[model samples]
Each structure stands twice: as C-alpha cells, then as structure tokens.
Target: MAPGLPTPKKYFVTAGAAEGSTPLNAFDNALLAARIGNVNLIRVSSILPPGTEFDPNLELPPGSLVPTAYGYIISTTPGEIISAACGVGISRESFGVIMEFSGKCTAQEARAQIENMIREAFARRGMELVDMKIEAVEHEVKRIACALAAVPLWY
Candidate 1:
C-alpha cells in the first residue's frame, strides 16, 4: 500500500433512525438524524487507534470521504421495531476495537449486545479496557424504518 496518512487520532460515535415511505428515503432520513447525511461515507472495519480522542458533537464538512464502522437495520413491516448499536473499547496499550449490531429489537438490547461483543473482543486480544463509548437507535416502522449506529474515525 502506498504510504497512507497517519493513523486517525480523533473519532466519534453516533446513532439515528427515521421512517419513510421508501427504504432509500428512510435511510436518508436516518443519516440526517446521525448528522452525516451530507458526506460520502467510506465504510471501514472496526479499529480505533490508541490515544484517539472522542468528540461527542463533531461535525464534518459536506462531501468529505468519512471512514466509519457501522451497523444498520431496515424494515418494511408496519409496527415492527428495529434497532442498531455500536460500541468502541479503548485499550491502554494498543488500538481500540469496535463492535456493531442490528436487529429487530429495542435500542437497549442492541446496546447491550454490542457491549458484550466489545468486551469479548478485548478479552480475546488480552487487552486492558481503559474506556468505552456506545450508541444506539431504534425505529418503529410505519411504512419503512431504518436504524444505524456508527463510529466515525477522523484524522
């Protein structure tokens, strides 16, 4: 690989959902809720650099190629509830890990599942958990519903 830019040092977690008549519209609305509707999302695998800073309210310029690890669920069944969740585990000595889950469930359930996944991931790597962040979203389908959770990594 050509020498890439340095590892990301900043990151943020976000989740959102929306209902629309069509799947695409619902996805767009959900992105709007997550505050990343305008950017070109480049989905990446889950890995956060050590020492990375977390920004609770970070905003990206429009059209930026944002890298993120995310999970999403879309449903068309009326009255069905769908949820998505993402979690990040920071390690004291190495890069952090991220886990995501999506399903027909409550936001709390999704969050709990991803938290367990993050803990297992850290334990598998024998890493010490220093901190963590989790976010989740739930949507009830009237026509179509979409839910998403993500960790957006910034340089």
Candidate 2:
C-alpha cells in the first residue's frame, strides 16, 4: 500500500534444475528454466496474502520487481544430488501459507518436507486447508548444479 509498492494480486508456482560451469550460473540457469530469471525477485516470507489468486500462465515483465518465496540448492560436488521444493496450502476462505525447502536430497524427499511443513503451518494457524499445490526439482551435479522451487506473487 504505497505509491510504487502495490500488493500482489496473483501468484504461481514453479521448479527447475540445471547444470553450469559455476554455482551462480547454475542458479541463474535454473531460475531461467523455471521461467523467472529475467525479473528482479524480491524474496518474501511464507504468507500468501488474502485474496491472491493462482495463475499458472503468468508472464512477468522483464526487470520488474517481483515478490517471491523460494528455495534453492547449488552443489559443486560431482555426482551429488540436490533438490528444492515449494508448497502452498490454501485455506477454505482466507489467506494461504507457503513453504519452501532445499538441500541434498531427492525431489520426492523435498516435496515430502514441503508438504509436512505446509500442514504444520496450517495447524499452527488453525486454518482449514482446502487446497494444496507443490512444485519440486532435483539436480545431479556435473561441474555445478542447481535446483530451485518458487512461489512468485504478482499483480
């Protein structure tokens, strides 16, 4: 609620994995693969504001300041596995909760962690979870690799 900082009205979930010559590059490429590398991401906490809707076909403007909740892992050890995951738990008639996790693990494991975290968050808030969405990615390191999962909120 400021002049140039408007509240987000829509959101989307995505995941990607990539290998690169360096760690940063791997992360950037992973974001690009996730379709969010062009914009400037302003990392935010794990709360989906009330009334925000989910849009899977969101096309963000390049260089825009996008608010996001994300988790990522970059590994340089060759053959090592890395994973990231994000989950959103929607309440019946109110705000939702977002959770992200990343580490040396499989995508399935990361997904499991995110799911449990979402459940715990809902329980802590005493909110009724009516819907859930999750995304995950896994990467196997060659030189350097990155796995990323994100929930990008936008207008």
Candidate 3:
C-alpha cells in the first residue's frame, strides 16, 4: 500500500466558547479555548478508526497536520445563543462513527442532535453501539462569538 498517515490510535473531544471582534477571530479564539488553536486542523468526514482510544489529556504540538471532525456556530446578534456539539459512537470491534451539529440553540439541543445522528449512523451500518463520547458548548453573543466542539484523531 502507498504510504499515508497511520491509523489513529487515540482521540479526544473538546468544547470551547469565546467572543471576539470579528467572526474569524471569534472562531479562532474558540479554538484556542478548546486547546487546539496552534495546530493545523484538517477537517475530515465522520469516521473513527477501529480500536481508537479516547484520550482527553492528549497534548498535540503546534503546527501539526491534525485530522479532526468538528462543529461550530458563530453569531453576531447580541443575546443570541449558539451551540455546537461533537459525538463519537463506538462498537465492540468495528470502525466507529462521528457526528457533529451546530445551530442557534442551546447546548443541550445541539447535544441531542448529535446523539440521534450517531445512533442513526450505527443503525444504518448494522453496528451495535456500545459507547459514546460527546462534547458540547454554547455561547451568548455580545458582538461576535463562537461555540465549538471537536473530535480530534491522533497517532
């Protein structure tokens, strides 16, 4: 097989909320709050490689090309609440699934959407879901604010 990134053996879920002067800056600040701002995040589709372990304490270096599944919401309206959530559903011995959702809603609503999506993904694949990890955050916008949730896959 041609060389490529090795299958990830560990992963982590993170959530952050922040406000900034601009939309991009708000998102960036949210990333910083999530502890993943320094690395280059390569957005990937929803899939958790088999046998991957959840490591919430995993520390990644700056400037690394990290594969991630994430969701975020940026709202400029004052007093508006925006929420985002990311979830992973794992089977006993099979490749898992990741789900993400964002909207102008509460964090609990975003989390509920993720949970349903993950369940549907597993059901469609005929896989028995055994476990899940989820992260969610909400932001009340003053000027520009972002709520972000992520599942980062690592070596």
Candidate 4:
C-alpha cells in the first residue's frame, strides 16, 4: 500500500464478556463496559465491500461499536445491539455483530477469517459456538449514539 493511497477500512470488535446483562449498578457491569471500551486492537478481515447498507435500525460501523469491518459485537444492552448491527425489531437475545471488509480482501475472505477468529475467541472464553443468522444489505452510515445509560438496578 502506498502512502496516501486509499487503504482498506479497519473495523473494531467489542463486547461484554459476562455472557448476559447484569445489574446496572453492579461493579461487574461497569468493569465489563470499561473493558469493552478499552479494546484498541482487534483482528479483522476485509470481507464485505465498504458502503454496504445495513438495516435502518442496526447501524453497522457506528461510533459505539469498536469500528470493525468483519467481526462480532456482543451486548446485553439494547443500545449497543442497535449501534453495532444496525438491526431493528430484534430481540435482546440477538447479539450485535457486523462484518465489513478490513483490508483489500474480498467479502468471502473477510467472512471466513472473521468466523474463525470469532470461533477461537469463543473457545478461549469457554463459551459454546452458536451460529448467527447474518444477512447483507445496503445501508447508509449514520451518526451513532455512544451513550451507555446508567439504568437503575433495584434488587
């Protein structure tokens, strides 16, 4: 790649490792969110082409979702899910994820690489590998809401 040349877009993958949503005020909740926000480097593949449209509600490449081309986005919170996948009318159990091209790789290559990476990540975390029903669609990029609201948790 030459300097000033159009480089492939980079996307970041982030998620809360605690499996599901926790009590809002719980220390684990805050810790997980912080951990998710701190992920600076992640392995991504160039799969889908840039400017691919996504579901109007599930905005991929949103500012809140670590910025990745092909990767996973886990969240127990509704906001994170919507920001990550641009998916609308989805249930909370539907984990947030997006796969865009990373470098100059084709969509297939990017998808394969990302799938493997996600599988490995799951194994390392001792979590079962569940399949995701992903669909490709054209969508416009929109401003993301990065706010993580502090929901009151009463126990």
Would you estimate the TM-scores of all the predictions?
0.94, 0.96, 0.97, 0.28
Pairs in clash, predicted candidate 1: none
Model 2 residue 49 lDDT score: 88
Task: Please give the range of 10 consecutive residues that has the lowest summed lDDT in model 1.
Answer: 4-13
RMSD of each: 1.4, 1.4, 0.8, 17.7
Clashing pairs in 3: none
Candidate 1, residues 34-99: lDDT per residue as tens digits?
988898888889899778888877879999888889989989999999999998998877899999
Once model 1 is optimally superposed onto the true structure by TM-score, how far is the C-alpha of residue 5 displaced, in angstroms?
4.4
Highest TM-score: which candidate? 3
Where is the poorest 10-residue window by lDDT in model 3?
1-10
The local distance difference test score of each candidate is 0.89, 0.93, 0.93, 0.29
- Candidate 1 segments exceeding 4 Å error: none
What TM-score does prediction 3 earn? Answer: 0.97
Q: Is candidate 2 or candidate 3 better by TM-score?
A: 3
lDDT (Cα, tens digit) per residue for candidate 4, span 1-155? 65762333322222222223333333243224524332332333323223333321332321242323322222334323221121111112322233322222233444455455555554554555444333221111122212121111010
State residue 79's C-alpha deviation in candidate 2, in Å.
0.7
Candidate 3, 1-155: lDDT as tens digits: 99987878899999999999999999999999999999999999979998898898999999998999999988889999999999999899989999999999999999999999999998999999999889999888899999999999998
User: What does the lDDT read for residue 98 in candidate 1?
Assistant: 92
**Candidate 2 off by > 4 Å:** 1-4
